[model samples]
Each structure stands twice: as structure tokens, then as C-alpha cells.
Target: MDTAAYALLVFGALAGGFVSGLAGFGTALMALGIWLYVLPPSLAVPLVLICSVVAQTATLPSMWRSFDFTLIWPFIVGGLAGVPVGTLLIAHADPQIFKLGVGLFLLVFPTVLFFNRTPMAFRFGGKVADAGVGFAGGVLGSLAGLSGPLPILWASLRGWGKDERRGIFQIFNWTVLLAALCYQAATGLIELKVIWLALIAFPGTIIGASLGTRLYHALSDRNFGDVVLGLLFLSGVGLVWSTLGLR
Candidate 1:
């Protein structure tokens, strides 16, 4: 690759890894725009998935004490069950319209939450509600590779603390992204070129992820919430931009 492409690749990986480490999600949201400028969607998308898994795994050890299996299992179960359903739905769905709708939701919902600092106090439905959000996230993930928004939004609305929110979404993202990576591998989407690109990107991902984890340790609860909201807002912009590009 030329120096410009190489630089963009490293920069994208760094940004993606940092966001994932700091917020428990958003690797693709931060990286894909830059990567897409240099690589085809075929290569850029899988590379985002691979780097995301790497970033999540690399930073997880720091949050090991906060790992709550009882809290996260329902979401995982619901997500796994929903993936096949989503895969089926993709056959009948209009992908661009689906992305546009999700893009709009991401834009409006986060803007509302950003303005309203008071967290909602509704605590009903317990794990069942969590699972339902996970199921929707899984369907979204399969449909548009967008599994983070619903659960993350639910966590915010439920008034979870920073660590608790991170614990839920981080582990959940790791599981879902890893599963998707494996599916790609099984289906022969992970080719030698992707491997080579990953090799180019891995160093930046690791370094950026490590730096982001340190920053995460420094954030107060309110500040962390702001960061998460900011990322979501940016994700909305990216989604809307991509959807509009199709027209």
C-alpha cells in the first residue's frame, strides 16, 4: 500500500481501538469512515470486526472484577437467539431504509438523552427487559452490524453507573463481535488480504486501546456518560452519512 493508505489504516485502527476501550463499543463507528476511504467495504468492514474483537479482548482484563455473569447472561442468550432471526429478516428487508431508520433513531434518541441529565427511574421488567433489548440489538447487529445502540441506550436509561454499563455492553459486544468474526471465518470472508491488513492495523489498535483504558480509569460517572453519548451521536452521524451516500 502507499504511505497515505497505510497512515489512514493505522489512524483508523487507533481511533477505533481507543473508542472501543473507552466506551465498550464503537470500533466500527470511529474506524470505518477512514478505512473506507482507503479500502473497499469488503475489506474495511471485516477489518473493523477483527480490530473490535481485539480491542475488547485486550482491555477486558482491567475490568475483570466488574464482570457479572448473572447480569449479562440474559442479554447474551437473547442476542444469540435473535441473530438467526435477523439473518432471515435481511432477505426481506431493505437494507438502506433499515440503516436510515436506525440512523435517525440514533440521532434523535441520543440528542434527547444528552439534554436530559436526569436518569429515568423505571426499574421494572428485570432481566426480561434486558433480554428483549439484547434480542433487538442482535437483530440490528445481523441486519446492519449495529448491536450496541439498543442495549447501550437501555443501560443509560436504566441509570447504570459507568462500570456497570461498561460491564454489560463490553462483554456483550465481545461475545457478539467474536461470534460474527467466527462466522465470517467459517464462510471464507477472512482472506489472506484481510490477514495482511490486520497485521498492519494490530499495533495501532493495541496501543490506542491501552491508552483509552487508562483514560477510562480517570473518568467520573457523569463524564463517562457524556463520552458514551458523544460516541453515540458520532455514530449516528456516520450512519446517516453512509445511508445518504447510497442515494
Candidate 2:
């Protein structure tokens, strides 16, 4: 890669890592945005996957105490089931259209929640609902390297506490992202260029994640929720812009 591409990759990694560390998600949204400016989607997507795994693993220890298998298993199972389907669609699906539809939903859903005066305690989704959300996440994960947004929105709407919500976000993302990585590897989508970029971006990932972890600790639950929503909104906007072929 050229010097400009290398710089953009490093910058993307740091920015993406910080968001992932703070919010337990968003590496692809942040990093891929920058990477796509300098590299093709083929290279950009795999690089984001590798760095996302790294960022997620880095922040896992901090969130380890919040892990709850009983609450998370359904989503995991559903997400796993959806990956192959998404991978299959990767070759045939119209990504721009798919992304545009998801982006609009994400943008609108959060806005409505933000403006609602009486935010009801909405904690009535059984495992089935959770599994459904997970399946959607899996499809998105495979199709766009974006599995966190749907689950994040679900947790937020369910009125989960910070730790509980983060447990779902961190663990769900790690599982789906790792699964996607493996699938890509098996299909030979992960090339040596992706690996080289990952190595070049590793240090930025560590630094950004460390800083974000510290920031995460300082925020109140309400503030953290707001931050997550804000990031999700930005992610939606980014998706829309990208799909329009504007950047």
C-alpha cells in the first residue's frame, strides 16, 4: 500500500478502536468509513474484521463481570445461524439497497426513542425475541460487518442497565465478528493485504481502546446510553452516505 493508504488505515484503526472500546461496538462503522476512502471494499471489510476482533478482545476483560450466558445464548445461537445466509447473499445481494434500508430504520428508530417523553420500561422480550434480533444481527454481520447496531438498539429499548446492555453488546459482537472472520478465511476472502494492514493498525487499536475504556468508566449510565445512541445515529448517517456512493 502507498503512504497515504497506510496513514488512513492507521487513523481508521485508532478511531474505530476508541468507539468500540467505549461503546462495546462500532469498529466497522468507524474504521471502514475511513478505509473505504483509500481502499476497495474487499480489502477494507476484512481489515476492519481483524481489527474489530482485536478491539473487542482488548475490552472484553473490563466487561467480563457483566457476562450473563442465560440472557445471551439465544442471541448467540440466532446470530450463528444467520451468518452463512448472509455470506451467501454477499455475492448476490445489493449492498447499497440493503444498507439504505437498515440505515433508515436505525436513524428513525433512535430518533423516536430520543423524543419520547415517557420512556417506558420495555423489558418484556422473551428469548424468542432476543433470538430474532440476534438472527438479524447475524445477517447484518455477514452482509455489512455490522452486527452490533440492532442488538444495541434492542438493549437500549429494553431499558437494560449499563452493564447488562454492554454484556450483550460486547459478547454478541465478539461472537458474530469472529464467526464472520472464520467464514471469510474459509472462503479465501481474507488476503495477505488484510493481514498486513491489521499489523500496521495494531498499535493504534491498543492506544485508542485504552483511552476509550477509561472514558467509559467515567460516564454515567444515562450519559453512556446517550453516547451509544448518538454513535448509532452517526453510523446510520454514514451508512446512508456510503450507500449513496457519496464517499
Q: Please, what is the TM-score per model? A: 0.91, 0.95
Candidate 1 to truth, TM: 0.91
lDDT of 1 by residue, 181-201 (tens): 676677676677998999999
Displacement of the residue 75 alpha carbon in candidate 2, Å = 1.1
- In terms of TM-score, the best-performing candidate is 2
Determine which window of 10 residues in candidate 1 has minimal summed lDDT.
Answer: 138-147
User: Model 2, range 31-89, lDDT digits (tens) per residue?
Assistant: 87788889887888778878888999998888798778787888899899988888888
- lDDT accuracy of residue 4 in candidate 1: 95
Candidate 2 achieves a global lDDT of 0.86
Alpha-carbon RMSD of each model: 2.2, 1.4
